[model samples]
Target: MVFVFGVNFPEQRLASLERFYGVGPQLSERLMARFHIHPTAKIGALGGRQITDLNAELTKLTIENDLRRKIQDNIKRLRDMGSYRGRRHAMGLPVRGQKTRTQITTARRLNRVDRKG
Candidate 1:
């Protein structure tokens, strides 16, 4: 296993690095390039130094629990301020101007004051 912060990634798995909450393909590619790691490399192929370096870089970014907390805090702040977006979140509706007449399942599930991701 290869551990990034508190998360354990299987060594046999590809080192996509998108498992972190706030990380995406672009950021993952940037990180891999910064570490001189190839895109198709496996977690097991990483050297100890590379792993440490990657950890160091990851720590510098707002990811995982920190990012989640930040988003939740922003929602809470909006709610406290009674903003339109806050009201939408509280109502479990779309906050990005999506139509609410139908097909709002995703927004209803995700747009809430206590969001997990």
Candidate 2:
């Protein structure tokens, strides 16, 4: 196993870095390129120095809980300001003008004043 940013990632392909919150395909590819790790490289195949470098790089990013908290803060700010989007989020409705006539379950589940990470 390899520990990256306080999370344990078992010996898996480098592409699995996308499993980290806020690290999408593009971000993961960039991270791999920076480390010179092959796309198919497994966690166990990484050298000691490479692992340390990865840990340092990940620490500089606002991923996982940090990113979630940042988003929640932004929503809270809007709510405090009484913005229209904040009202929608507070009411558990679509915030981006999506039709609420059908398929609004996603909005109700996600757009909330106190959203869970």
Candidate 3:
């Protein structure tokens, strides 16, 4: 059961042939029609508007622009820090603390590789 705007809706739908206590049968039908609530005999009006609003709120959260700005700002700050060591550490790459003598490998593209080989 869901309550919306101080209105209580039953878990089961109201019978199409039956009349609701406060709302008459015809009035109930009209309310259901206006709100696009399912007319199934077992489930009362589930309040579609409330569900729609909830979905909209979820969409708003997913598309928030402030979160994007914060992420960009953090990346920019990491990039601006002086010194190669600090920059590498901020970017999650191998820093000077790690030994790279024989472990580090560089890429050889077609333009850089020796054609004589």
Residue 19, model 1: lDDT of: 84
Query: Per-residue lDDT tens digits of candidate 2, residues 13-86?
Result: 45357887899989998998999988888888899898899889988999988899998999999999999999
Name the runs in model 1 displaced over 4 angstroms: none
Please give, for residues 18-100, the per-residue lDDT of candidate 1 as tens digits.
98889999999999999999998999999999999999999999999999999999999999999999999999999989999
Ordered by lDDT, highest first, the candidates read 1, 2, 3
lDDT of each: 0.93, 0.87, 0.44
Best-matching candidate per TM-score: 1
TM-score of each: 0.94, 0.93, 0.27
True-structure Cα RMSD, model 3: 19.6
- The global Cα lDDT (0 to 1) of model 1 is 0.93
lDDT of 3 by residue, 5-34 (tens): 233556563533233223457755665465
Identify the leading candidate in terms of lDDT.
1
Query: Could you tell me the C-alpha RMSD of candidate 1 in Å?
Result: 1.1
TM-score ranking, best first: 1, 2, 3
TM-score of 2: 0.93
Residue-level error in angstroms, candidate 2, position 75? 0.3
TM-score of 1: 0.94
lDDT of predicted model 2: 0.87
